[model samples]
Target: MRLPIPTLALIASILSVVTAKSSTGDRVLVVLESGIEKGDYSKFWKSLEARGYSLTFKSPKDDTAELIKYGERKYDHLIMYAPGQKTFSPALSPQSILHAQLDGLNTLYLLSPSLSPLNRDTFREYDLEFTDSSAGNTLISPFSSLASDPSSPLIFPAHSPLLSSSPANPVLSPSTLSGGPIVFPEAISHFAGETPYGFPILGAPRGSYVGGSGGNSNSTAGEGRKGGEVVLAGKMAGVVSAFQTRDNVRIGFVGSGKALSDKVWEASVEDQEGVTHRTANAAFAQDLTSWVFQETGVLRVECATHWSKTGGEVEKAEYRKNEEVAYSVSITQYSPSSGTYIPLVTPPSDLQLEFTMLDPFVRTPLILNSTASSAQGSTTYSASFRAPDRHGVFKFVVEYWRPGYTYLRSSTTTAVVPLRHDEHKRFITGAYPFYGATVSVSVAFVLFCGMWLGMGEERGRKKAE
Candidate 1:
């Protein structure tokens, strides 16, 4: 009797699963507070689990709440689901989040529908402000599908490559949307103060104000009245705000949690051409996750320059033909975690150098000479080559471009020319025949003049006699 295909598939699947688990170690730690609804995250958690991550959930009330634990050590990620308590202490405060980040842990924090009494001093320390105001409200634009159906409790604006399609634009045409969720705050503001590392993720619709009673108020009110109107009648808007601290810690502020609801997570938006589609919250969530996970591309050096050791104090503006010179270059890489710059190296080695003019004259692989104090960590390329005999404005150039690394470009020009006034050989062996001919002519003339004088004297004596 032949075995059933289902049984055979099940065995194969189990074997594959075992093999995957043995090779991969991925885990997540979710910290949810009391009373917050677990909406689309449930689906997301399942997806993560399916991707071979072990998901663990905890609350601030748990005995181990203060401790972030993983398989052998601590969690690789921390998901904060809006704590309702008054204050998150140092052990549970935002500093804890920073600590986790310092340890290379990724974090995601969601905004709560209701404001918690917790004083976000830590966030304030980073120049972020969260507030509650009656003046804050969402607006539906004629451009959005939500505007067409005011009664639709769950409305998705449009599909965005940067965001999932379920949540579409409510004001601009869905086609104009690039990111997910235009978060309009009833009243919210973030001031960067001395440091402006915080980048705005969304802005208010055109002609929107942040304060006031949200009614018709002219601009020419009394001084006190104007101030009051500005404070109380202006509109507030922000979809998501993010900041990177001097220490390289990133924090994102979300104004509305309803946008990430379970139903919205499953909703998708179709492109205008109808060629592509994306879920509203899914795309946004994916992008946000990628950013928080530090997977986004960071800074890279595009280029650099270096001078030669013997290029003189002025750095040799030009080079002459047959002149020998040396040059070096340095390229670097950017690290988002430490927010520091690091030097780049060749594959089998740490650094490389080149000597070039128009085309590379010398392509030499450099080896780090730690024994040499001048080149301890640096790779030096040194060589002596005569400039091409051709006379022209030629440059000594080194151009280096590495993937995910800074680019290096360096050049020095030396004007090479045919032998100069003092450069030519004083006497030419090939002109010996011409030199001898000229000398012989001068001697013959001198001899002829002397003989003519003697002949004159002799003729005078004969006349006297």
Candidate 2:
């Protein structure tokens, strides 16, 4: 008997609630400025929805815009598009949003030149410092022929020295190099501090600088201008960047909200050669969100185990010193298109496993074991080596960190106990010389005793005579 239509619809809804499109989760809360409508970012929103994300839009000051309820996060991701808004509802305060991120919410901040002080400070916490938006410090590229004025929004060539994409990074597709130039309309550039957890997705053009229309970045502005400083210039500026927390939560920073808007999505851009082409913002934005929302470059450790190769024991908590040991871990990466985790067919060449005790005693590469990876949706990595001769507590650690991928970490502790006295071998083949020497000494003693006894008996017969 087939289920009714209503029943089917209910089942679908239930499944949607339980299953997440992004590896992190699917619920997204987009906090828009008061005057801004969700329609302003319709294309961006629609793309996310197409990937099965449920978006909830609210004004910055809306009292109902609560990110957390009863100490539980109601959403898995957040989009803060209120660049000009200075005040937010209590529930959506900067502290609260940060708290939500700490609770595992991925956040995307779309900023404007008139960035609010609150937002600037919040971004500073991530080691990002934006140009003074109030001073009209928009990034300008002199090489772009598209803009009539020197200070007009800059257009950058899609690839290389002009605008570099982190293709090695999963945040942008490899096809981005062949795509059209990206347009930065009224863009606000920023300086990113050195951080291991952060990386730039799109770098500023080579000639771009934060200054007025006619000023040379290297020279001081004329008379009375004692301190005319160029905040950032050249590749020092960041157009877009991302940060990943230790927990694998992601946060993205876009210099201009308009970059992802429908206007830019449907617009065209011109390169330095005056060749006009469609904008690459749509594809770039999609790839950016795909990473920031954990749709791609997401990794999961399916299983990890260690065992004694000599004893044929699996996952034993203890092992004898100098024992031949084996370790294996299975991992998978999420595929947004299929909404499932698939095996990372080509394992990272640098992936390593460390058997450490305070310091690593054995550091070896985790070679892909195709035969052991017969299970679906995971790739198994294995390594075999002898345990350290010294007996002590040690941990098997796997730390895999790349720019765009989720940081994978797995640690298992085990003890290496000394062999028991009874566990020692009774005889050894390598001591043949000592064994022969003992036999020779025993024969010599027996012969000496027989001669002494014979001599004593002969003396006794003489005394009787």
Candidate 3:
């Protein structure tokens, strides 16, 4: 028998809930200030949901404010959008942020007018500092332009392959909206003294500064007059900045909240809604969120070595001049899923090996051998070439760089010397004529001496008789 309409509806609702739950396998926790406009991120967040991300909303007042528990990451991603006073509760202290990072949770900090409170001395332990200063101002360009009209809403440009690769998909189409001019009252500045692993995604041109009337009284300059002279100047200057940890946790900071406001997203010049430009903003948000959520790819070279084949090991200290030497290099790439390193095929083609004394003697490209295999799953590059005729000191070098890969450099030094006295051949094709002439002269002199001695002996015998 067919079920009643109420029963059918209930079954459908249950199925829908199950599907929704399945769709969001990973959770994205968003921490917002009590009364901020969060609708600006709606489209961006929906885009992320479409890509299989589950989102959670919370505030500093939540009973469970801390993002980590029992040394485990509670959320895959943490987004702070326009936080206000006491935004992060005491439980979510700087230690909590550090722990979450250590646990590999990604973070994205969105800025607004009231970000100063969060940047207080209490949070400095987390490697983030917020200043009321505004001297740091600069603009970035997208990889390409997005404006339909010559004079339309502008969007920020981001062409770095790192931003587009893997977990971070720089939304190119949506960034077109960022082509128009963007005006800012204050710009966030990142300092020079940051963690070695921290990378700046966007920044102002060096020496550029935001000029404003009021200086930040709360800021401390290294060795200058009070705040206004250059409250936020130098290396860091951008509305948005990003940093990455050694463990790959990413933290993004947007200096101003209005940068992502719906009014800004929907704003148009001459009453024409610039949807194309709008797409860029949405794409930027989506890309950054994806990066924080661990959807991007990170490639690193584990090992690079070069050696001669004769000894079956890396070449030793020296080689004879013009000696034929075989060279090879082995490398491995990292895989997060396997939790083990694996050999890489098609290692970058640009890897160059050079035999140089002072200048290069033989500079040649290394070709990876697809036919060769090893337990490491790595491909080997091999070549055989004679050492340079003239050599004192020579080195083999390889420099490899690709869009999203860490650089690889390999070099080995070996001394090459000329032939020793006994090492030279007794006779050579080029010296045959000289050898023949010397032999002829030696024979003639021997015969002449024998004849002269015989004649002298005969004369002496005759005189005695």
Candidate 4:
């Protein structure tokens, strides 16, 4: 039997609420390598589904898996797990992927040691340079590896120095950081250039090095030679990295696909010291996906207002020079658990505001308004300062950039006009001296003229006598 119209509408609303997981959108495209089964990373897939994402799996050879259509993104996010595949669909080309990201599609890229030239060039565009694959470069660490075999995978212990993180980094939550070690197999070392948009998520251990011979070698990266040279060592090596465009498009690069495999998620790792540790791969994978999918570290400016403190006027089109002004902006951060934007209780201490013309005239920190923030599910940051003495078209700009978080930028423009003639002071203390001098000069000139006329009259009377 056909459902009633009202019932159908109700069902559709429920479905919409259920699928709204990501702050951006819920549509995800998973591009898999040929012959790879979906069950290979079942846990990862399930987690995405649980979070309400609608995933579409496609092979690299599938022509129908287009990321863009009619100059718009078909999917909100793209997951390319087909590492080491030499060929890809034309719609998924490197340039195409880059353009899709520009169109606001977040992406995740899993890579292998053997990178095709196309992949290399693509990553290079993001300032990520991997070790030379032709030289048989493999990341090896005797102390961190499971065994003496050069082919053995490496393990990062709890709070491993190799896993670089910051409190501000949303990619690794506090629980994940304090959790079990991560098992990294078939690790390919790479280097990240100095780019503000990109940063390394995982660094190589102190003694780890990438060289041609994947064997136990004591030589550092500088001393390696012969058939294979060490291309990266220590902190210079990175296994995982991330890039976020200015438009808030996020991209993640994992050097090894096995790291996200179900087998690795359940596997335990033992270092050379014979200490066994549970794998945090599952947690790491979730966090990575959560971030790239815009489920975490997402921020939105709800509203911003500026007004003259003295006049109590808000959102005026123009402001007078030297007026005390107050600016406040409401910001909300996306919460995956609630599936909504919530107040940012603890905003960054460095959140700042700048009043700018050609250059910044006023720069100050934006303080949190606790009462206002608690009322709504958003944080309100406000700053009060005197408008610059110089008058011109000025902008109230707030630029908050932190790694693993969305770049927050808000700019509001208003003209700062010179004071009106009636607004000018009737008397200026600094001009008192000039005023007194003018009056004295006038009086002296009048007395001189009177004396000259009196002398001329006396001379004329003497001549008549």
The alpha-carbon lDDT assigned to residue 346 of candidate 2 equals: 51
Could you give candidate 2's per-residue lDDT for residues 1-465 as a string of tens digits?
A: 999999999888766534547877889999989756678788988878866899998888888888889998899999999988999899889998889889999999998777888888888999989888323567766665244543434443354321332335566676765677666676778898988887777767777777544243333322224335556777888878889999888999988787887877857755556667788778778777888899878988988999989767567999999999999999998876667888884567678999999999999999988887776558999998899999999999999988878899999999999989999878788998999899999999999999999999999999999
Better of 1 and 4 by lDDT: 4
Local lDDT at 363 for model 2 = 96
Q: What RMSD does each model have against the real structure?
A: 12.9, 5.6, 10.6, 7.2
Mark the regions of model 1 whose C-alpha exceeds 4 Å error after superposition.
1-27, 47-54, 67-73, 117-119, 134-145, 148-194, 207-236, 266-279, 299-465
Q: After superposition, how far is residue 95 of candidate 3 from its true place, in Å?
A: 1.0
Superposed by TM-score, candidate 1 places the C-alpha of residue 164 at a distance from the truth, in angstroms, of 22
lDDT for each of the candidates?
Answer: 0.46, 0.79, 0.54, 0.81
lDDT of 1 at 200: 46
Instruction: Superpose all Cα atoms of candidate 2 onto the true structure and report the RMSD in Å to 1 decimal.
Output: 5.6
lDDT of candidate 4 over 174-234, digit per residue (tens): 7777787676777787899989998777776677777745344444434557435666777
- Most lDDT-accurate candidate: 4
Which residue pairs collide, candidate 2? none
lDDT of 1 at 196: 55
Model 2 lowest lDDT segment of ten: 218-227
